[model samples]
Target: MSAIGGPCDRALWYGFRWASPKRFDAATLKRFADGHQTEAVAIARLKACDQLEVYDLSPDTGRQFGFEDHHGHFRGHMDGVILGLLQAPKTWHVLEIKAVSDAKFRELEKAVEKVGEKLALREWSETYYAQAVLYMDYADLDRHYCVVCTPGCRRWMAVRTERDKPEAGRLRGRAQTIIASDSPPPRISEAPDYYQCRWCDHAPVCHQGEQALSHCRTCLHSTPVEGGEWHCARWARKISVEEQREGCPAHLYIPGLVPGEQVDAGPDWVEYRLPDGSVWRDGGAAYTIGDTIEAEAYRHAA
Candidate 1:
C-alpha cells in the first residue's frame, strides 16, 4: 500500500536486492564487480581443498531452477548454483563461495537454505538432492555444506536441519486456505515472537521493530543482581509513554533500503548511507559506559 518505499519497507528491498546477482552488478561499479575474480579464487580454493569436485548447475545443463516467469505469473529461479556443485558417493552439496566473515557466513547460510528450498519444490526434488540435499520434507543427508572464503579467512559450515513440524503444517494449511478461498493466509489468534519475527516478510503489520525490544538480549535497564541470574524478566519492561515522548533514536531513524544503496558493517558499527541521508548504529548499549555516553549521544543525534 505504501508503494513498497518507506523506512519500514527497506527490509523488503534489502531482502530481494542483494540476493540477485543482476542487482549487485547494476548497483556496483565495473571495478567493484569482482564476482568473476571471486569465482576464480573460489575455484582454486576448492581445488586445493580436495574435498569436493565442482560443476556449474546452469540451465544449459538441461535443468531448470531459480526464478522463472511461469505462464503469465512470475515464479522464482532456484537452480543457479553459485559455486562448486559437488558430489561424494551419494552425498550432494551446493557450495557457495563468499568473502567469509561472521556476518557473511550467516547471510550466505540463510540465502542457500531459502533458495535451495525453492528449487527443490519447483524443480525435481531428486535433481536438487543430487546437487544439494534440500530440507523440503526431511533431513536425510549427513552434510549440507556451503564454503565461505574471505581474503584471509576461509570457513565452511553444514546446514543444520530443523524438525519444524508445526511450521510445515502451517505452510500446508496456508496452501489449502488459498486454494479454497482465493485469499492470502488467515489472521491467527496469536502472533509470532520477535526472534522468529525477522524472517516474516509481513512483520510490519504488528510494529515488529518496536516489538523487538522485548527480545533484546542486552538492555541497560536490566538489573544485574547475582553471580548467575536470568535477567530477562527484569529487563522486559515494555516501551513506556515517557520513552516514546522522549523520541527513542531507534524509532525515529531506520536506514531502509533505497533502490540503489549499499550497506557496510565495520568492526565497531554498521553504517547505511544513501544520497539523501545516513545512519550509524553504536556498537551496543552493553559496551557504552560513563563519558563514552556523550559520543553515543552525538552519534545518534540527527
Candidate 2:
C-alpha cells in the first residue's frame, strides 16, 4: 500500500472521507509543489511592499496561528495575516494567497466583475470560500483579503470578504462527522465509471471498500492517545497525526478488518468475496495490483 502522510490526510478540505482520498501521481504532485514555489515568490514580492506589514505563518517553526476543535481532531493552519492595504487601512485581515493558471485567473476576475466578490466566490469556487471562512473564524478576524495571482504574471487581484459564521459551522460539523465514523461516507456516485471517480487518485482504493486498510488510524496497530496522538505498535513509537494519517510501508491490517468472506489466502495476501461478487485483495501493496488493467488492455490492443 502507498504510505500515508499526516493528520492533514483526514482534513475535510482534502475531501478524503467525503469524496475519495487524494492520491497524487508524480505529475500532479510536481504541479502542486510548483504552485507553492510560485506562491512563495509572490508572497515575497507582497512583503516587499512598504504599505503592508505581512506576517508569514507558512513557516513550520514560527509564530503561526492554528486551531484545534474541541476533541482536537480537526486542525487548520493559516497562511498569514496582513495589517495594512490600500483598500482597507488600519485594519487587520487574514491573508489568503492562491496561484491559479491564467485561464482560472480570468474566470475569477470575470466572476468578481459580474456578480461581485462574495457571490462570485460562492458560485465559482466553494473550496476557496470555505477555506477563507475557516481561516477567518479561527484567526478571530472579521475581514479577509484574498490575493490571487497567475504563474508568469505580476498582476494580482485582491478580493475582500467578511466572516461567514454559518458556513464555517457547517464545515466544522462535516469535519466532526468524518473523524467520528469508521466507514467512509457514500461516494458521489454508485457507478465506477463516473467522471469524477475516473480522475480521482483514490479511485483504486475507494471502489475496493475494506480491502484498502491504508489509513493508519483505521489500522488495528494504531491506538489513540489523550490528545489525538496516535501510537503505532508496529513502530513502537508515538506517531504524529500526520504520520498516522500517512500510513507507513510496513502497515498491516488487523485480522478480519474487512467484512467479507475470504475466498483465497496466501502468506502475504488474501482475497475476499464481496457481496457484489467483486474480489477485494488485502495485503502488502496488493491494493495496486489490479489498478493497471486499462493500461494493460491498451498495450495489448496496440
Candidate 3:
C-alpha cells in the first residue's frame, strides 16, 4: 500500500522483486518496537474515550483489521476501525495509528492551521496519506482517522481524511501496472546522487549496475501468479515465500542485471563476459552464487 503510491516506481519495483534483503540498524529496529508500543497505548486511550467505539482487533478472527488485493500481493493491516464517534455515530472509519517526533507533531499542528489536517497530511508525509487513502478504499469506508502520537506516546493528535475515489482508482491501476511489469519502470532520477536515488537501498543495483541479491523473486525464471503465489519457470511449481528467499541451484539472473556481456547461453545456463575478459556462467550446474562451499570456492572464478 505504501510503496504502490510512492513517487518512485523503479524503487518500488526493485523492492517488490526482492532486489535486496531488507536490513535495519539497531536504532531502526528499536524505533519499530517503539511504534508497536505506541499503537497499544493509542488503542487503550481510544477505548477509554466514552464516545468512540474502537475495535482494534476483530471479534471473529481475533486479529487486527487486514485487507488484501491483487492476488494478495498488495495488502495492509489497519490499526483498527472506529465507530460511534461524536461526529459520526453510525458510520465506520478506517483507523491508522502512527508515532511521529515532537517536531513532526508540531509540523502537523502548523499544517492543520494552514490547510486543515486532512489536506495537511500530504505535507506531513505522502506515505502516510497514501496508506490512509488505500485503507479507506479497502475497508469500504468514506473516511479515515489517523492518530499521530509523539515518540514516547506522550501526546497524540487526530486527523480526518475523506475518500478520493479517483485517486484510489489511479493507485489501483498503478499497482497493477507495477506488478505486471517484467522490468523496472523509468527511474525517478537517473543520476546516482539524485536526492531520491542517493538514499534508496536499491541504488547499488539500479544505478551502480551491481547484481541484486540472489533470490527467486530476483531471478528471471520467477513470476508472480494467482493466489498470492510465485511460480518459477525453471521449476514449474508454485514456490512458497521461504522457498523464494532461498533460491535453488538453477537460479538464473535476469539478463539486465548481469552487468556483463552475454557471449553464450543454454537451457538452465547463461554465460557472460566480464569487463576484464573473464568468463562467468550461472545456472545449469554453473558458478551459482548460492550459499555453498562450491560458490565460495568459485567466488572469484569469473
Give stretches of model 1 more than 4 Å off. Answer: 1-44, 47-51, 59-90, 96-143, 148-154, 158-181, 187-201, 205-302
What residue runs in model 2 are displaced by over 4 Å at the alpha carbon? Answer: 1-26, 58-61, 208-210, 213-215, 220-225, 231-273, 276-302
* lDDT to native, each model: 0.35, 0.65, 0.82
lDDT per residue, candidate 3, 1-46, as tens digits?
Answer: 8667678988888888888668999999998989889988988988
Pull out the clashing pairs in model 2. 1-285, 4-246, 4-247, 5-246, 6-242, 7-241, 7-242
Off by over 4 Å in 3: 260-264, 272-280, 284-302
What lDDT would candidate 3 get against the real structure? 0.82
Specify the highest-TM-score model's number: 3
Top of the candidates by lDDT: 3
Window of ten residues with lowest summed lDDT in model 3: 293-302
Residue-level lDDT of model 1, residues 1-302, one tens digit each, is 11111122223332222211123355454424454465556656556755555443454666533321112121222222322333344454434343444675666457656765333221222222322323222223244443444434445443422233443344334322322221122223235564534444545433232212211112222222232122222224333324322322222122231111436644333454544565544343333332366545633443
Instruction: Show pairs that collide, candidate 1.
Output: 65-78, 65-79, 66-76, 66-77, 66-78, 66-79, 67-76, 67-77, 68-76
Instruction: Say which prediction, candidate 1 or candidate 2, comes out ahead on lDDT.
Output: 2
* Winner by TM-score between candidate 2 and candidate 1: 2
